[model samples]
Target: MAIMDLSSLNNLNLDAGSIFLLAITICAFLIPVVVILPPVGLQKGDALLQTHTKAGVEGARSNLKNQFSAEEHAPADGKPPRVHSLVVYPVKSCRGIELARSRVLPSGLQFDRLFMFAQLKSPFPVAVDSTDAEKSQHKWEFVTQRQFSRLANVTVDLWLPDEMKLRKQSMRSDEAFLILRFPWKEDGWRGLFATIAAKLGRGRAAEPEIEVLLPVDFPSAAEIKEKGYTFENVKIWKETINALNMENELPDELRRYLGVSNKLALFRVDPEQLREVYRCAPSEEEAGYQPVTGFQDAYPLHLMNLSSVQKFSSEVPKDDDLKELDVLRFRPNIILSGAPAYDEETWKQIRLKPGSSSLYNDVSFHVSCRTVRCKMPNVDQESGLRHPREPDKSLRAQRAVDEGAPLMGCLGMQLTPLFDPSLGEDRAAWIAVGMTIDVEERGNHVYIKQ
Candidate 1:
């Protein structure tokens, strides 16, 4: 294939290096490298530099169709999305911990909810762990799932003391200690010999399983709250907030299996004390930072939309005391995937990106509202039992259309963690579980979540 002899190409001296090598071999195989610039009055040693290279490829394709038509009038399809799952809860409407990766704190995950259940303050029988030093002047009222739906089968598991020499250690939840394991059922014959020795797997203790360890307190001195804490303000809804009780020691068989009387009292949320999401931002020192929380009733990350929770599991009401319904009854602490169910209410802010703990990449979060739907998703975190009227009666017949949030049923949102590097913040951005989201959308509206 070596010809080059068109009559000696007119004695071949077409200089300017053979017309810029024949205009880059006929426009570098045709266009698109920002149309090889050099237009608006062409210059590269012009001899009509190949006739202004088609006016620099139609001005780089009309400036790439006006910047993708301004990203099709932006609001994010900037494309990213994926983090499928990673729950936390660690006590406060209990039973949570599902992680293939986690530690994105600020307030969510990383020992979320911190530890709750207060109410033992007024009148009612109160006497299970009654250390009668005049019952430390009784007064502790938080208790949740609206009002104890067995507080969702309470379960918490955290370990620290040198396993793998502190695998990626992160501290300050008062330095580790939360074991708690419970569940007991007995009626007769010591629950019938602990249910016939459980088919011989050695099931004793009248078959209810126990395990406790507790001790993780740190509200920090001032005499431990001027003398062994009992502070407690706790309301969480109209946000009374501020808690401390829990001098650590709860076990009279977990106050008769959480019926709560024997001096249970464990509330905790006071370190660095900020709690002001001021109802969707603009308070924690005017949003410069600080949305602190512990017994999370409101904000510190939630985000759920596994296809709008499998389409709200066929919109509830499916017979036999309502079963098939667990996206952990809307508890969510990050669980997105692809999009469109309720299309994550239309995002507002998301970033994430980093799946295997290099400490986590990007990591953002702003979505501050729409979690509304209370009645604590009708309880049932594995039979803590509550389902009286499902999904708030099918979310008041099709998501109550938000009249500024009446009879709520919103489906996941609420996040705050703006920065973290272990809170001193210089951006560590951590977040796990498949991680990779981007989203933004500021207009498809969604706010109301008092």
Candidate 2:
């Protein structure tokens, strides 16, 4: 790079104002290459973000025809697949709660993705030059592990007052609570000792774990209307939802734990509002029902086979000292076992065999599409640390099976429950561990661009 001659500006014989304008012009061209361009190349965050494109859609649909000529059915082997694990994330991107049994609802497993963390909107006006989209981004936006990997360490549990004997003495039986537990805010030498002790599984260090109790059923919609309770419009993907702000209930310790200096708040999805699934949704004639979701990234439910995860782990590069990759990293609502690896790729519908808690019909889930992967799985659930690269590299190398999202790797299947209209919304069914999973239907999945 040649150094510009400072003497040339004086030789131009221009006024001070003109000289300043000329300098600004020079900087406009040079600054992008020197400062902005290099950082954007270094960031690589946009590559991890999924974008829908016309070419991707065309490629996926064109390849779908060649993928499967006819529908495939489940094998009739003596040992059928069974539900191995059930997990639900009450808060988006936070640690999930594993259950032996959970009530299946129209939206999803009860309490799944009902709450989320978001960056609060600024009180000031938007920038004058900002576009509508940029202005919208200034409002409350959803936060996730992709931006804050430490969220993985935040453990969440749903507690009903009726279930606990001690709570009954202090509160009404109908009252419920969402128990949030996270690392205690510590710094300096004490923070080091606490982190080390926590890693070593010492009992003493566990006492510093901060617990916050949030009323799951507080500040009803009626209360919001009457008292003008605090609320904000939170943007999740392309949708903006009206959410009840619960930041007042959380302590300042949480903000420190999240490493957020700006305004951050906890929000509960409004029960009165219903957000329906858009991408790859079946027609009412085909599904006989409309599927809905809360704060979930996409569909109502997500399922991953243990065999598929095991296969994926084996293929991932083991260059790091990190532990083996498991299904937990993908955060599936249901984990199925006893099936061959990648067998779900062809599955179109799955039925939970009617057992002792059977309703009039078997509970079925329609396979929406293959879940496209991002860098989120790189975040370790237990340690809350994100690996620089490994699984994501492996995913791009081998798991880019979906032609629709050819650049993206895929692991699990997105599912929407087949709601029986006659059953009514109030009637719910229970899905327990060890329930037999029957592949009721199978076909090639078509990826509909979001």
Candidate 3:
């Protein structure tokens, strides 16, 4: 190591003022450098000062960077992966909207999974202190594409300014209102029209004419135990927590739309207060990862790999439509391209460097864990029909983690945005398409094979 020179200190007079000046100079030079270096054998007085004076700040800074920078791990892929596309499903299981760009919120993309459809009878008032799972107040079970493939046909669009103006009281913002598109009911005017047409000579009746459209708005209802905003205890999977469940014509509107007795509600993740992310790794828990999410299935973000999707498709018996499954079937917040097939499965963290777009600048995310997928992937996103086999079948043949829990056929991974240490959960840096990704950490490509 090249040593730094400290001859300038001796030029000062040997007076009281000179001595104090010498002391400050010594401290300023040694503080930054001493932390990284080892305890060395020090010669008496003058020799010790001379040795340390040669230990420069540059070496200390280099060591610090190496210890903390993204490149500390195996240097990221030479070509650096780029975001291929982005999708945000505002409502769970509903069709996802592809975006050229999107705001990266702590709970995932903005407006993603905020609203959901639930069984009508399944919703009932929950007692604040009830021990029975069903008795919990405002408890409702949500439905998804996993249960109904037609859910993919229920496309959602955001309302514009004029539309929001008409329903401002119910909708929080102009863009907040969702224009829900539903498939035509099997039994309705079209059914009668088709029945008559069959008698008139038009062969078999065409499927219900087309689709029905509805606008949904969430109006504030009575406040609950959570203090301020409308709070309800909603059960998802095995967990139930307090969330905002707005009341209005929406529940009835959705009921009529689906021809089912079900409740519909929007979840608002209050910035001041937040829902915690559970089951984090021990390291993340120690790092203070009590992150808040809105209506995401679990983690704030889901990342998919295009190569993995293609590789999986290659393994399945080819059909024209199935061949065209694309990335939408996976419903990921971010998609990465150019990485080797299934390579992302080994990543632990990624740093997203912005491309030409300024929207994605200096955003990094930590991989929470692998995404345990459901049968939702088996449903073709385009036709809103189940493929019966292939992706799910092939995945099961290769990637079942546990026969007891078949949902563990991992395809993608969940990501938690790593916020500035000072900001914590208060704010999240946004990311967008065309962003270049750098893998900052990697783990052994290990999986539980049942």
Choose the strongest candidate by lDDT. Answer: 2
Prediction 3 TM-score vs. true: 0.64
Off by over 4 Å in 2: 1-77, 121-137, 163-172, 186-202, 205-207, 221-228, 354-361
For candidate 1, the lDDT comes to 0.61
How well is each residue in 1-450 modelled by candidate 1, as lDDT tens digits?
889787788787787998999999877766554244422232122321222111111223321223212223222365455665677776677766666566665666666777776655654565887766655565556777666676566666654444333343432222455666666657888765555544233324324445555545564577565556666676656667676767455656566676765355667677566475656743555334666667787777788766666676677768776756667677787776656667667666666767444556677777766677767787777677777788788876778655678666677777776664355654334566556776654535445456
Q: All candidates' TM-scores?
A: 0.28, 0.74, 0.64
Q: How close is each model in CA RMSD to the real structure?
A: 29.6, 20.4, 29.1
For TM-score, the strongest prediction is 2
Candidate closer to the true structure by TM-score (higher is better), 1 or 3: 3
lDDT of 2 at 89: 89
Alpha-carbon local distance difference test for all models: 0.61, 0.74, 0.61
Tell me how many clashing residue pairs each candidate has.
Answer: 4, 0, 9
Which residue pairs does candidate 2 place in steric collision? none
- Residue-level lDDT tens digits of model 3 in 312-431: 666777686576555678888887766776788788888989875665568878776777766788888868878777577777766664343464577887788776667765665667
